[model samples]
Target: MRKKLKEKISEALSSVLPITVIVLLLSFTLAPMPIGTLLLFLLGAAMLIVGMGFFSLGADMAMMPIGEQMGRKLGGRWKLIAVAVICFLIGAMVTIAEPDLQVLARQVPAVPDAVIILAVAAGVGVFLVVSMLRTRFNLPLGPTLIALYTGVFLLSIFVPNAFLAVAFDSGGVTTGPITVPFLMALGTGMASIKGRDEDNFGMVALCSVGPILAVMLLGLCYQSTEVSYTPFAIPSVFDSQDVGAQFLQGLPDYMKEVALGLLPIILFFAVFQLASIRLKRRAVIKIIVGIGYTYVGLVLFLTGANIGFMPAGYYLGTTLAALPQYWMLVPIGMVVGYFIVAAEPAVHVLNRQVEDVTSGAIPQKAIGLALSIGVAVSIGLAMLRVCLGIPIYYLLVPGYAVALLLTRCVPRIFTAIAFDSGGVASGPMTATFLLPLTMGACEALGRDILTDAFGVVAMVAMTPLITIQLLGLIYQRKIRRTRDVTQAEEREIEFVDEIIDYNEEVEL
Candidate 1:
């Protein structure tokens, strides 16, 4: 356990250190921030490192097992209606508790936070049922995604344009840190019983869809024209004591929030364990420890992110965008996007799972690089849109069209991984940091926040669908080449044997 904790901390540091360095460099060179803000950012980075370490370990120890056990048991004996209800409850519970969803809910001005949260949660519940049914019936994922997304776009036309980006962003943030590990494990457990390799993935991808559709419908109903944008206030701290006080002040609220977020999951596990799971006492004890770790980690993580990184992101975006050379936003955003995705804890979880599931054929290093490149391109495009005031649909429609087109060209497993990667890439960092950065830039540019600044997550989510599928295309080609080479070698060996036999017959 100590070794695992140490390893997770090391991974967290490596993941976070790059982004921290980048932010510091920007503060010093390009967008100089106050000393207090810088200190707060550094302190936040420390908490993030520690928090991610504990959180990753907790998810592996507790959430994954619970999800897997439930999936295996449910897949075997539960009636369809029962399965649907349980899945809905699980989806709604986890989503409501998702930190990313809460962050987004706070950002949107038109609807009450509870309304957005509930709407998004209910959406996830419905789609989770759809995803489970798809896995059980062995339905084609590509056609289903195409049809669903087609419906989403069609619905978007009637919904307020301002809400379109928010609707899509909902999908990306729904499959965040808390949701991904459990849902992915659940899919794996369910797929194991279904006797299909590809079914283990695409559950996150499908579940992500529910929020977009639900939010779009909600947008139509709410029909609010004005969105209020409130920027994070940069902290004023003159000393180390002040930084300590700031973090300490904010810590308890997040602690309570995280605890409330975790309670439902713990209770659900307990009820299910008593009713059907009946896990061993030793296992239950381990999970209890894990839940404790998860609680502490999330509190620290959210506190650090909200207090430290949020202001830095907003300040940096505003300062950079306000520069005479405002065009620098594109490249700078691209660079930040490249590294920030690596910092997202959920991205680490998804990459590790993908590597494990593919038995290292799809290497973690490869997935990381592909995701970075995809996110970089997406951020560049997002900054461009923010700068130029382009409609998001202009990029999204073509992007999804190409992603769906590639579905026919790659293996189904890769398709599933690609789509799931899209959701994973746009986790907490995008919601807490990138979204604020975009909003800041839009505010500086005097553009409509609702339309211009709202879709960074959607863009982050969209590009991975194409890039990973492109990686899949490459994988398929390599597989075909290897097969051809092996066949050629076999034929050559047969031809050599035939010559040897002919020579022997001639001698006879």
Candidate 2:
């Protein structure tokens, strides 16, 4: 156990260290902040690394197993309606558990946070029902996604522009750290009963769609107004002691937040254990310990992200935009984006599951690289929008169109994984750091934060659909070529053997 925990922390160090280095470089060269702020940022990075490490381990221990067990129960001979209702409840409850959703909920100005969160949860529940039914009935994911997203765009017409961006961004944030492992594992459990690779992958994809549709509908009901965003306040600290005090002050709030976020899941699992799925006592204890790890990890991670990273991202963005060479935002953002996706806790969950689901036919490394490139492009585009004020629809409409188009072009399993990657790529890290960065830049440039800076997560979500599918195309072509070569060699060997056999017969 100690070895495994050490390994998890080590993996997190590698994942987080590059982004930290980049931020340090930026601080020293292009976007210097006060030494106190930099020190806070460094402390936050350290906490982030440790928190993610423990969180990843906890997910493996608790969330994945719970999801798999629940999925097994779901695979029973329940009526379709029963399954749908259960799935809806699970989907809604699990979404509310996501810390990333809370982060996003705070940013949108006019809507009550509870209203937005509940609406998004309802959307997830409904779509998760669809996902389960589709799996049970053997439906094609591509057509279903196309139909739903088509409706999404149609609904976007009625939504206020500010709300539209938030609506789309909500899709990305919904499938965050707490939700990803469970959803992915649920898909795996379903597949274990009676499913293919595609079945093991598309739950997250389907669930991601629910929030966008729900939020857009909510926007239609609500009145539009000029939304105001208060940018991050740079910290003022005299000494290192004050910085420690700041983190200590923030820790209790996050502990309570994490506790509340986890309570539903723990209670639900308890009920589930007593009612439907009983496990060994030892297993239950392990899960309990894992939950403890998750709580501790999340509290640390949130405290760091909210207190340390937010201000740094804000200052960096504002300082860079204030420069004469503001075009540097695009290139700098691209670099940051490339490395940042690796640091996302949900991303590692997806990558691990993808590799495990495919039995390493698709590697973790390949998924990581594809996701990095996709996020890099997305962030660059997002920064460009901040500088030039491009409406998000201009990019999202065509981007999703192409993504939906590729659903038909690539292998179906890859399509599932690709869409799932879109959601995974835009987890807590994107919401916490990248969104703040864009918001800061928008504030500095006097752009509308709602319309201009809000949809960066959506952009982060969209590009992976295309890039991973493109990777799939490459994978398919390679397989075809290898098959052709093997067939050719087999034919040649058969001809040569026939020749030898004929000669031996003649000699006999």
Candidate 3:
């Protein structure tokens, strides 16, 4: 257990440190923020690292094992019903806990935070069950995604434009740090029971569709009012002490928010431990400790992104964007996007899970490369939208269409991980930094901010679908060629065996 803790802590730090370096460089070179703000940002980054370390450790200790164990035990009388109920609850709990969603929920006008959280949670629940069902009966991943997305597109025709981007953003945001690790492990663990490799891969893919439909339906329900929210600018104060104090005061609110978010998952796990599976007491205790880490990490993560990082990002973009050379938006935004995706707490968990799920055949580095490219493209496209004042649908519709089409060509598991990547990639950093930066750029360029600036998150969410699926297609083709070579070898061996047998018979 001690070794496990050390390893987890080391991994989290390693993951976050690179991003912190980039942030520091950005602060000094690009933003050149005040000393007070820089100090606050560094403090926030430290908290984020510590929080993430504890959180990932806790998740390893509790969430992944518990999910796998429960999934493995889900057999016998009323198992189907039982699995469905558990899936729904897990989906709801994790989605509610998503930090990115909480960020977006706060920004959304005329909607209670709870309302948006619940709506997104419910969406995740419904889709998770569908994912489980796909596992139970070998449903082809491509057709299912195509059908579901086709339905979503048809619905998009009448949905309010204001809600469209927000709705899609909800889909991506709901699958955050706590949710991604747990869901991927749960799906893989559940697949283990069937003893089928193909069954394991598509759970992430299938579950992604749930939020899209849910949010689109949500768009239909909430009459689209034009988004009127303008982000609050971070005031540049000379006093470092005051900046520290303001951050500390704001920290507790996020602590409370994350505490509430984690409660449902903990309670559900507890109930599962006692009533149904009856695991040993020691294991349960370990999981409980893990839950503590997850909660602490989540609280700190939110505080850093919102209080420290967000304002810095907004101010930086506003400053750089105001320059006469509007093209500065493209390169700076792209560089930031490249490093920023690595900072997202969920991306670490996602990459690790993908490697584990594929047994190193799909390397974490590969996943990172794919993500970097996708994010780069998304950032570029987002800047274009901001510059041209283009409607998000024009980009989103085509991107998703290509992504969904690729799902058919790629392997089943890749499809799941790819879709899941979409959600994982568009996490807190995207919201706090990328969104604000794009917004600032748009405001500077004199473009329509709502229609243009608002959909960067959506774009961030969409591009991964294409890149990961492209990865999947490449993997599938490789797998096929390998199989062909193996088959040829087997045939040659069989021919040799037959010749030997004939000679022995003739000699006899």
If scored against the real structure, what TM-score would every candidate get? Answer: 0.97, 0.96, 0.89
Clashes of each: 0, 0, 3
Put down candidate 1 lDDT per residue, 1-508, tens digits, no spaces. 9999999999999989999999999998989998888888898989999999999999888877877888897677689999999999999998888766776676567788899899889989898999889988889898898898888878888987767887888889778777788898899889889887678889899999988987787778878754555655667888889999999999988887778777777888888899988989999999999888887778878888888888788888899999999889999999999998888877877887888777788999888988999999999999999899999999999999999999988999888988998998988788778988888888899988778888899999999999989988888899999999999999999999999999999999
What TM-score would you give candidate 2 relative to the actual structure? 0.96
Model 1: CA > 4 A from native: 106-112
Please list all clashing residue pairs in model 3, or write none if there are none.
Answer: 58-290, 201-413, 205-416
Clashes of 3: 3
In the predicted model 2, the residue pairs found to clash are none
* Residue 151 lDDT, candidate 2, scale 0-100: 88
Model 2 accuracy (lDDT, Cα) = 0.87
Please name the candidate that would achieve the greatest lDDT relative to the true structure. 2
- The model with the greater TM-score, 1 or 3, is 1
* Residues 292-389 of candidate 2: C-alpha lDDT, one tens digit per residue: 88888878888887787887888899999999999899999999999999988888888888888888999999999999999999999999999999
**Backbone clashes in model 1, listed as residue pairs:** none
